[model samples]
Target: MTSLLSVTDLSRSPDLEEVSFTVERGEVVCVVGPPGNGGATLMECLAGTGEPDAGHIELLGVTVGPGDRRPPGLGAALRGEALPARMKVAEAMRLLSRLYGTRGLPGRLVDLLDLEPLLPKRFGRLTDGQRRRVMIGLALVGNPELVLLDDPTAGLGEGSRRRIEQAVDEVRAAYGGVCVVLDDLAQAERLADRVVLLRAGRVLAEGTPTRLIKLLGSTYVMGVPPHLRVDGLRDVRVLRGAAATYLYGSRPALEAAIQDLSPMSGDRVWSIRTPTLRDAYLTLSAVPEPAALEA
Candidate 1:
């Protein structure tokens, strides 16, 4: 199969360092790295929004050498005021569609994003979730062969999140493109075909989420809902929505929760490890930064 995007000996300046990766046609390549490690910069470079100090960026098999190249429709990504706050949802999308000569940008996007009824609402009147969906639709409207998404599901409720996840899948399936999404590991696992672990702007380990978790050993062969048994833990403190409570037990909260809800509660056994993307991420970027947590 032909590779849609490839970066050989791809290195960025003093900050990004040496980087290399590839995305074949119809594949999702997620670049996962700890915060403050230049993941955002990579997106900017790949999307032609920012210049990389040095590196070769290939898009659709065409070489984009040094300095960001404004690939056909990439210019719109850097437009100021991502969405027109004063414009009605329908009106704004229509304008963008016309500008790009791509009709149905708004009406079809509304359905894809579950925003059919929201199209009538002015941008300012929409809720945060509504706004997010609209913005995402516009971002994808350019028919980009490569999409860079930062926290795609941020600020949305669980139901909305599932929808966003499904939308992402559809985008890849229909567009035959590569979408680089940045988010917690859980989100990555849900959307990515492969994971690239990075640290301080360098690739550390790259593989499927499950393989990385195992390579990480007991460090993160763990995690679950707020309340679950954690392997090799005497106790755990779960901090959710600002209130911190300690779950003290001989096992992880997941194991305990399982036993508590078991059909044979009287003879029940243990817990569960949901294996989220966040779990894998922390393991790849773990540095015992307790002091930073307080900061």
Candidate 2:
């Protein structure tokens, strides 16, 4: 089946490079990576707000080139997009609904996003989280075939983030359209059907959450002091961070390594846990660039 959205060989100098991905209907594809990884630029290109230097985007079966207007069935809730400060939330939603030709108010979206209380308030009076919820609601006004949400939950409190996640789930259940969410690794793990990991303006990895976590090739992660050494241990991959040195390996290897350090003071601390998407991301990001490895 044809994808709802296809981005092929998309590039923008200094921000993106040959990035390609597809989003099938009823799927949520979260794009995530470290800071300066070009996610913002990619979202702009997908939303048709910024022209890519090369390649193309196909949205809902229409091929869109650089400088072209965004396709009719595409909706975006991009970060920093502004609404008129004087406009009430309900008024904004109704206006967008009319503009998109959707019948009546987006009542389902308002309830799904828990916006009833804020509906009477002006855009400028809402807090960051409330404003984000409103933006998402506005984006879904027309039930567009493809939805682009850039960092929708950025800087939100836990409660607000959960509400957004729930709202996203409700939107998917109601519309079944493809969603492309630009977020961090944690949110990607919770919200994405598949994740695309980017770094230095290039695709690093892409897969379901479990599949991406498995890329670390370890069942457990043991964290110890950065100065501690586990170099001689078999099957252990060491990732030294500023705060802790993570040792990624199987259960037996970690157990043996811990035993070897049993004589250390009780105050010496260590921790062991299963590998997560964040761990896989860190491991992949730590890899030497292809050119450096080849050299």
Candidate 3:
């Protein structure tokens, strides 16, 4: 399997400390981490919009770092991309089509993004979701071999979100392009073939979503009363909420703890389930602030 993009020991000053990953062709790799932890920087580095302070970045057989121009055959749509306010959707698409040597929508991007009705709409007048759908179409205009998306569906309504998700699946399957996405755990689970967990700009864990989730072993979540002091459970991952004390651990261990506690009240209401990518993510990332941990 040939790697479409590779980053070796990538580092940037404040946000990105040291990061590395490989994106293979036809793979949707999701990059997840604590907010403000440099996931955006990583995308920029790959897209050549920004350069890393140190380390190597290679895409499509081309090397890019500080001062190097972005290579062709790659497309990216980062957050807050500002399109010309007055430009109509058709006009913008036409211009991009010319630039990419495509006379119209590249492949099925027009239909995939449901952009037909939006063609006459002004960019400024479009809602955030509409703008994102346009941006997604724009990214595909060049028929790129790799697409770098920074939360493509973030802040959108459910309808637009589902559309983008469907478009992504279709694009990857039809075009065999690689995608590197920066998004939340749920989206990562839905879209990623491989997941990278980052904290403080460093790679904490990287593997298939299932593989990472399995690292924690058969996890069972038990709910206890908030007033119950659970500081004694040294071997479990606990998330305390206002109404319930959520305990995450192996089924047998949680059962043992429950037996030891001998639930007196509502603590009897508990549920056990397998750990998800979100669970593994929370466990690996940990809570950012001390307040989140203090019960």
lDDT at 293, model 2: 12
Distance from true location, Cα of 244 in model 1, Å = 14
CA RMSD per model (angstroms): 7.7, 3.2, 4.9
> How many clashes in candidate 1?
14
Clashing pairs for model 3 are none
**How close is every model to the real structure, measured as TM-score?**
0.70, 0.92, 0.87
Query: How does model 3 fare in lDDT?
Result: 0.77
Q: Please give the lDDT score for candidate 1.
A: 0.60
Name the regions of candidate 1 deviating beyond 4 angstroms: 9-14, 65-69, 73-81, 106-109, 216-295
lDDT of model 3 at position 261: 67
Least well predicted 10-residue stretch by lDDT in candidate 3: 286-295
Give the C-alpha miss distance for residue 250 in model 2, angstroms: 1.4
Sorted on lDDT, highest at the top, how do the candidates line up? 2, 3, 1
* Per-residue lDDT of candidate 3, residues 1-295 (tens digit): 6577888889998878667788777778888875787888888777777877899888887887677877778878888896889999989888988998877675466776889999999999999999999998888787778888888887888889888888778657865555555657878887888888877788878889888877666557677789887877756777776777778887888877776667555446456667788777666656452111100
Tens-digit lDDT track of model 1 for 1-295: 5566766555567547767777665667777765777677777677666677766777776778555454664322321234566789878777777776786454554666887887788888887777777777776666666655665665579877777677667767865555564646666776777776666777666666667655433421222344433334334333232222122223454354444445433453433344455554554454442111100
Please identify which of the two predictions, 2 or 3, would achieve the higher lDDT against the true structure: 2
CA lDDT scores, all candidates in order: 0.60, 0.81, 0.77
| lDDT by residue for model 2 (240-274), tens | 99998889888998887787765653556557789
User: Which is the leading candidate under TM-score?
Assistant: 2
